[model samples]
Target: MAVAAAQELDELCYLSAQAMGSLTVSEHFHVIKLLGEGSYGKVMLAVHRKRGSPMALKFFPRESTTLASFLREYNLSLSYCTHPSLTRALGIFFSTPDYYVFAQQAGLYGDLYSVIVSEEGMEEERIQRVMAQLSGAVTHLHSLGFVHRDIKPENIFLCDSSCRWVKLGDFGLARAVGSTVRAVWYESPFCTPEVGPAKEAEKEWERRQEEGTEEEMEDTWITVEPGIDSWALGMLTYCLLTGCFPWEESTHDDRRYRKYEEWFEIERAHDKTDCYAIMEERYRENPPPSQFHGIGSLAMALFKELLNPEPKQRGSPEEILSYLGGPWLLGSEREQRRRAQEAQKEAQKVSETGGLKDELLREGKGER
Candidate 1:
């Protein structure tokens, strides 16, 4: 049958790919089909030859980047390896001049974006489970002093079994707490614009260029806080519940940016637009979750808090966990509050410390 022939060809491709370059399939891992491909690399599904456990192998081009860059990303990804709601990075392998491979635990059910699109309608319980898993993953990342930077549905995967454990993966853009240069659109609105050299800076550079005295542009960057991740989380929740992007305009409105801008201005002028009012007026502001046949007010509230434009006002992961009635809610909230108190104490201690030993003494007292 045609299906049988296709399967055979797929097997051949998998075997050949596993053997490509420096990778060997000995008795450890048997490569399956390609899982997905992105701008930087590709992910392939492989099963442990002896144990039969599935895993993912991501291949990146080492020649295209420096060792420092690879090491930074590797270390950041490693920090979350122990989180149950996150995909585990197994190891990194360098086989050929063209490839830098990263192996990780595989997800059986693929990404949430594809799953939701295929199923058409996800049950309320399923949606909550996915959100809770995502919240936990994000919270863990924040606690570890890192930002995922990208939290879209395509990056979230599900396990194979009936339980469908959600796992947050794909850390290619993740960075340390203070690093900026976040992916466009996903950047927090509260963060300053990622504009190039200011007009004055550019003009000065031009004048210096004519005189051949121009200094190289210093690498200026911004600092994004955990609040930005919370905003993207809101957007993802909205998309999952509505099956459409929060800012995407409907065809009936011609889906034009100009129209969207106009509507945004109107909404800004009058803050009294109800859910129905916004949906009917702009057609770009997505319909409320309550408008969705199966979704309810709790879902709507979650989305609203997540997407609030003000960064300081955005809900913390602890707050979100509490809102969802997650098991970790109470403990996480207490931990967050404790950390805040400790931070305030540390700040006060620093103010009183005239020298390094004073700071150390304060820390010693706290430890005791």
Candidate 2:
């Protein structure tokens, strides 16, 4: 019996050593499943051989110019993205000359895009929370002098089953406040106007070249404005609340530009404008389904402010927080009614005082 026990202990130690063997990009991680695949590369759900920890391993093609850009952003995140809403690249390994892998926390529920576009859309309160978190993350990035040019549903990963926690990932398109590059880093219909030429859409780039205007000196660097990210955030908010883009999907650059230009012209003609330009015209021409309505006035107001056609007119991340904090200037129906009542009472008091209160005004004038 003693010999049998000794033999069992020896076997257990050998197994333990095997499990704890040296970890490497190729050897340490075993790919359990492919999480996602995209143009850049593929993401795999992997397990650390020795630690047995679940990790999301993202692989990138090395030969592409995008690899360096992605690595730069990942390195930046590792240094400064400590916020809960931002996903961090925990570890990295060069599996081969042609491939790079990064280990990060795996999202159980997948990305926000899949969730919203799927049959189970999110609720209004949940949308607010998601926006709040996204706002916080963007604000943090701005404070650090960086802008996440790509702010879309696909990049937002739900960290919990409740959909309350999320982490913004994919910084390949992100850039510093002062730095500029000609390449568009992300592909989504939610990009801002200023981000037009330099987006993931090859059609836009091709159009610029065809127009004989895209040529630049090797060292030319356009100063980037962080406001573009804010605009994208607005687009993101609209998508989260409505589960669809505000405008019809346009694949060609000319088509997208025409829609924007027409809306801008209409906006310049009118004194009052909502979140989008030519909204009435769009509705009249192509009315969305009934399910698109009822996103609430407060949300719409915020969306309009964020999606302001003119980049300068759009609110900064800080300003957006203020709006959200005040619940969008007495945004609720009851709050609006209360505000109107206060205004009426103030007007009545002014009438009673008969405009500037005679004696006090005279005394002030005499002193002057």
Candidate 3:
């Protein structure tokens, strides 16, 4: 079994590199510290020896990276670097067995996931601004004929402690809009309702294998559509407001799945309640900062459009921006002042907290 497992591991795309502590790349940047690591690769905080500019250098292990995939990401980064809402990739360089992506350091408040989870939750105006940026970024990507298959809080980076600015990062899962590769390997709660592991199909495949009738897995061929990002944005909005995912898991077999089904359920029973109504009530009870004073109604209206079960009817990025107008979309002097105030508040909060077991907050500062 050990031998078989080792063989299976060897077949994976990632090639193991030597331990990376205190490593430097391209003879210019000196590694200061390790940021994070995952199945694909790890990120490091580095400084350019000559310019003294700090950067977050992402190292993708060559063993796991294909030439095509590498080029795809590199080109996409270059193409989207000009956008204010997308992280700027300075350049790409190859160092022995690994490829390095040098990008502008993102997030002073860390990723949205950490901020939302730590702060208990966010106010409505803040959420509207954040969502506007995110949805607008997605719209830009779609206009360029690419789909950001993975749109979640973790991929959304906050530029400062105030949460005024956000940039989308990590393009590894991105694909052309009409590409045949339509499946997500890992299930994310932020994914569209229809997007998830094809458990039933996988079980059938398992049965076929047991019966010695080999069949190709049809799971990867799930239809890809443009509304995927919009659906995910809706889920992200939900998390921002509630500090929790709408569903516990992205599978249909679970009871939590019924919560989503019940929302769009056509036949309403006596005991059933409209999900939108319940959400609106909850928002009123525990609301976020709102520019419009009574943003709950406006928010519910947008959520109704964004969270629509039908992909065709789901709100587009343009529609979202239209719904959240003035400072949220086009930006105004008032928006600038509000952000400055928020930033000041954030700094005060950090000082008050004084690093009391807040590793994530500390890390965010360190990363910046």
Candidate 4:
């Protein structure tokens, strides 16, 4: 996507912010610029009028989100955003007649999706640091009994372009339920079999529509598990390693995923079946099957754990820590990148002990 120039972006951001009712908002904040906007609403860069501190103001339109749903999301943001690797929401939430608004520490570098697109892919060592932070954040959220249902590239924000500071954001789809029944309209790449079959789930969802259900449900009831986030983490790691996706979606309807699923099924029965070999023989002329080429053996091993078709067999997000000690890039790329990153860090080391959680807390209490 083409990024607008600084002047044009500022002008465009001001124009977008002008469309919303600004009386209450302007009283609290001076809109600095528009960060990003989507179907949900706009996220604006603003500064507190009284404190003069920067914040990212997220606005959810009433037409798109209900009061209950919006409040649920806001509450979850307040409850769990405290994790350093989780985007920290300011202790502020209020509603306008047309919007539900909240504040967060400004993610100056934008989201992970933009980074993946711009940088092509990341180095193995950086991926390690990123996954380390994310795994910790996922574990933190799950430990509190909440699942970040939507853990995708777009929702993972970057505080630094190099991904040294990344956080998981967007809790609109998060649910704390022991089990949930949602209406699935489309196949999602991050979901696995135990999340339930997409075709069957869609039928149930459609039945709800046929019955004139007022609120659209998105999935069929299934017990919540860490596999949900683990599967997504796999997808995130895949994108970080390879700029492209292994499949369009995880459903059988997707040809690429079907090929992968078939291989995985056989892989279960024959533990000796090498995925890399299958890629070489089957798609020899087709850029190799499953995009498994060029990745390290250890990474392929990790992928099997994260992308296991069966959710019951899927690895937890915390399992990523086990692989951190090993190489994830093929050949000498891992050592090369690792040493370069170390040298880069040696110049100016950033302390990891006091992170955003403490900083945000102090800021909230007016102690910073």
* Candidate 1 residue lDDT tens string, 56-94: 877777767554454444444544546888887775444
Error (Å) of candidate 1 at residue 171 is 0.9
Q: Any runs in candidate 2 off by more than 4 Å, and if so which?
A: 1-26, 65-67, 117-121, 183-188, 195-222, 249-293, 323-368
TM-score of each: 0.60, 0.65, 0.68, 0.73
Clashes of each: 1, 2, 11, 10
Candidate 1 error regions (>4 Å) = 1-28, 48-52, 118-121, 161-163, 182-221, 249-295, 325-368
lDDT: worst 10-residue window of model 2: 325-334
Q: Mark the regions of model 3 whose C-alpha exceeds 4 Å error after superposition.
A: 1-26, 99-101, 208-216, 265-297, 325-368
**Could you tell me the TM-score of candidate 3?**
0.68
What TM-score does candidate 1 get on C-alpha atoms?
0.60
TM-score of 2: 0.65
Clashing pairs in 2: 184-198, 275-304
Report the Cα lDDT for residue 340, model 2. 85
Angstrom error at residue 334, model 4: 9.3
Encode model 2's per-residue lDDT on 159-255: one tens digit a residue.
8766799989887677667665674433455655665544434554567778897664232234566778877887777676556665543223545
Q: Residue by residue across 52-124, what tens digits does model 4's lDDT show?
A: 8999999999788876665566656765567899887786777787888988878889887886753257777
Q: Which one wins by TM-score: 2 or 4?
A: 4
Query: Comparing candidate 1 with candidate 2, which one achieves the higher lDDT?
Result: 2
Clashes of 1: 1
Give lDDT for model 2: 0.64
Error of 4 at 39 (Å): 2.7
Residue pairs in candidate 1 whose N, alpha carbon or C atoms collide under 3 angstroms: 28-49
